[model samples]
Target: MFKDTNQEDYGSTRVEKDSIGEKKIAADSYYGINSIRARENFNISRENVHPELIRSIAVIKQAAAATNYELGLLEEGKKDAILEACSEIINSNVAEELKLDAFQGGAGTSTNMLVNEIAANRALEILGHKKGDYHIIHPNDDLNKGQSTNDVYPTALRIAVLKLLVPLTESVSKLQSALQAKEKEFSSIIKLGRTQLQDAVPITLGQEFSAYAEAVNRDRWRLYKITDRLKKINLGGTAVGTGLNTSHSYIFKIAKQLRNFSGLSLSHSENMIDITQNMDIFVEVSGLLKAAAVNLNKIASDLRLLASGPAGGIGEIRLPAVQAGSSIMPGKVNPVICEMINQLSIEVICCDQAITMAARDGQLELNAFGPLIASKILKSLEMMKNGIDKFVDKCIKGIEVNQDRCQQILDNSLAVITSLVPYIGYDQASILAREVRESDKTLRELIVEKNIFSKSELEEILKIENMTSPGRKK
Candidate 1:
């Protein structure tokens, strides 16, 4: 989306060449020869490369230009033009020029070249040259100098992953905060608690929500900590992380340039070959995301159980009615939000398996599955963040408790006898519980009539405040 201020006329088709042969692409296209070949070869995955990965590659190109210019390997004009082109990619939708398929094969070489080619043509335009004038500034020579797909793609992928994680963690934090708010609001409401779909004991709704909050908080921190290893990159490791064909000064200086350009606290990996050869870092990230998804699935299942029915089921809490749940079943409402979350969580867990298989199947020099890994991980993060945000805004924030339903269930259930166990022995409490479940008399009547506890004592013991934690003033 650039205006031809230089007023150069363009033709319909232009010829471009690589090691294999020459191919004709659109004269107006910003993508170059390798992109043409890649577009033809890897058309299976129609999905465009992740936008954040494109931005990250552009960032690495800027850093490379700066470092090359400092080392006197690149001309000042070329460096400035490349920087301008990369800035355009980063700060604008000019990154849409990177149109190669995300699921490209073999360690993302096509995707890397596509970024380099896009920057080259855009820079050529900035310098008043035609689109495909590689004589002045070439994609591989100038734009991709001192880097290889091995180092550059993984480094950019890491940068992209770190960038994408910000919103996801924020979403998790919001969910945790919302649950905690519910915890405080429902602190006084006593409800039935179940284990294996059977009544277990009495628990305040606040306590249930508090447990949910704690689980989410743990997942947030789990994602936060596993990303530390990702900050170490192998930028200078050219083809196989050995720093071959690159100077020692270049190897050491690229990290600082990358940090300055990307604004991330990055460092050089102590062993570049190891980082390049093994993609365990990505596997670790995916596993943590799976943990988060598992927690969310459990929480969603709980909400659905608590909000099961208005008259026929548990009916302890009421979910927000965000949509018409049925087309023909008049006045039917369902827990669609929680159901959607359940589906999303299952998808994320499956994606983790894909990422794991990608990591596990890599060979000695480099992992050829970077493209798949990047695409899946980035999509998972985005889905999770958006799902959590919607769940909070549409479901959690608007939920209401069926207080009367909860109280009725608490009064009729045998779970309340657990609180009386410490006062009367477990054997006697069990007998009273069985009798109440079978006979028409309530627990209060059965306990008082059996002379185990008087009416006043029964009333004091079964008070809502005394049912939970001990030592409260009546």
Candidate 2:
């Protein structure tokens, strides 16, 4: 008979078996054991455990245990043990070896396994027992008791998003500050404003900066609102949106426990069926991410164009130089950071689309594709957060306005004709602007030659601020 050999190490054990001839096979002893099988089974690489999401799992576990304690579902001793174990895992400074592969099936089962192994081993130490001994707080029996992959995974995603949302909001606030600073610095400067990429009117640099600041603030509010909706936890909804095998007391208890642990003001979701089947929340969050991405992309595009050339392009703004642009191009300082932010925005937009598709692909009770949703959303959050930080620090903070360029563009724009409407008549101003455009001369020069108004009088009337708020300007 083939015999299984149980070998004991110092505080650790390995299960081995002699199959066929003399070949010995050993069972995996770490949290990533299932990951090996999952990798082979699915052979899919698109769904991997992101590090942020992995860290978030620990947060979710803590939140769950905390909720349990707060609601008295778990005794003080048990809660302390669980929390101690979780804390050990989170605080441990392990290298890259502990990280799980990003792509795994079963809706982030690999990450769950990783956390289980780490927490289980740490708990073993806490209990003065050998590691890999599932007896005192077994990974599946005690640690994951009353929890299912369905609810736990999604709850973890929400927690992770919440963690990221804090910093993202802060970054948005920083961006606003930078824009406001620029607004004040450039208040007296004016430039030709564009509509559909063509010169339309004249506006102060301050007003343009204020518009950007408002857009970022709007995005911040959108993200904040989306996160509020996400705070509703599905922890009580065990497998298949049913509290099957879960104690009725444990249901409410866990939510309360998690709320205390996370300090997130979390509540039990009103509808488990909707929570389980509808991934629209992810879509909603993703849409916010997309909007933020679009905003950043627009801002980045504007920066790049504004800093385009001292000789050929607008050259109306200068961005900070973090790295040399090209190896061969002399004095070429590229807007690499802004370009990186733009690329990240594109990636986030793509992730949003992937989230949309995954949400729509859900068939009945479960989305079956939550792994993808989780990965994409988490990725987008991380990218956005990092990109915003870098963009703010490396680009926005050091941005300098070219006042001379601004004045030149403003003086050359035919849009000043609008300011002449009250004095020269709209028909005359229109005729003058057309003549100026045809002759390739400055609008001021054209107005002078046409005897539309004296130079000093035109200067006083055609101040950029006066064009938009006609009555407010003195």
Candidate 3:
């Protein structure tokens, strides 16, 4: 036989080679080796799992492990090991260090792998060993034990929505507050109310601001309603909807654990099969987001229109100078911030369509496109949050009413057609309105030309308060 040349010398010992002529590795050399296979296997990337969703998944895993430990489903050593691992991951130093791409397949399998590797390493550290030793807590058998991607992914999605709902509600509330303040400040001011873009009647600026506030209030309530549904989680319905391989005790234990960890008043869903197969809940939430986007878009449009121009536009409101509006036009400050918000709102509306399509694409037992749903929903949430903050700080809070301009428009307005009612009577007032429109004459000039009332009488009668107050002048 020829002398074998595949063997390698390490110090004084000869290390034997494998069939492929590769040297055998020590146990430490193969740390976290399983994650490589997981990473490669689930490589279908239509969309990336968002960071917010990842944090949500980590939270759910921590909650489940804590609950199982508390309920005695796990022994003391294993419970401590698991909790220690979860705590380390939760308070990890390497969270910011993770630079992997977010678009792994299988509804965030790469994310799952990342979480598992981090948690496993943390668990090993707690057990007085080096990281990536799968003995104390294997990523699958221990860290992700008693759970499946089906349950975990959906649970994480819901929890992410729940967490986001708080900030969203706060932002809406702040907008409402700003509107209320504007209403009070503009209470005495009157402006022409337009119907079909034509001057109709005189209305207080306060009334207009109040309407904006009320619209946001309605959107806030809509968000609250959808967020209530997010409280239901499918943590125990591992793999499929049946909870087959999981013990009944384990299901309840995990739910209870999650409740304590998240402090969200979470509970197990009643129909696990329906929850697994249907993404209707996500659609409902996205619909609410679309509703919010519509309201915000409308508000932003109104802001732009109301702040239209210093010379040619409505010029009824003035926005603070946040930045230069144009590069070529000197002293040109545009409503660019509100425009940005409007564009963001449009994108949010489109994301809602993506959510609707993803929900409808679900097949019999599994919705194979969950990763897209998670991605779209999270994007909607973050964009809405950012838009709300910018609109508030850059536009709403800095808004100043152009009092002189408002009064100029109001004085020239033919909206005073109602003022002639008490003096010229309804029929004569109607004629005067028609005549004013036909001749394009100011309401005050018409009242004076027809001598409908004495000048002093007209002055007292045409006061803005007389028009806006619910009570008629005696």
TM-score of each: 0.96, 0.86, 0.85
Pairs that collide, model 2:
47-102, 47-103, 48-102, 48-103, 49-102, 66-257, 67-257, 67-258, 68-257
Higher-scoring candidate on lDDT, 2 or 3:
3
lDDT score of residue 143 within candidate 1: 95
For model 1, residues 393-446, the per-residue Cα lDDT tens digits are: 989998889999998987778887887877878998888888887899988887
Judging by lDDT against the true structure, name the best candidate: 1
**Global lDDT of each model?**
0.88, 0.74, 0.74
Poorly placed runs, candidate 2 (over 4 Å): 1-13, 16-29, 39-48, 59-80, 93-97, 422-426, 439-460, 472-474
lDDT of 2 by residue, 330-434 (tens): 888988988998899889999999999988998787777888888788888878888898988889989998989987887666777777777768898778877
Ten-residue region with minimum lDDT total, candidate 3: 1-10
Overall local distance difference test of candidate 2: 0.74
The segments of candidate 3 whose C-alpha lies over 4 angstroms from its true place after superposition are 1-48, 67-75, 92-104, 130-132, 418-431, 437-441, 454-457, 469-471
Clashes of each: 0, 9, 1
Winning model by TM-score: 1
Model 3: per-residue lDDT, tens digit, 84-136? 66555455533434333444456555566567656666666667776545656
Worst 10 residues of 1 by lDDT: 2-11
Ordering by lDDT: 1, 3, 2
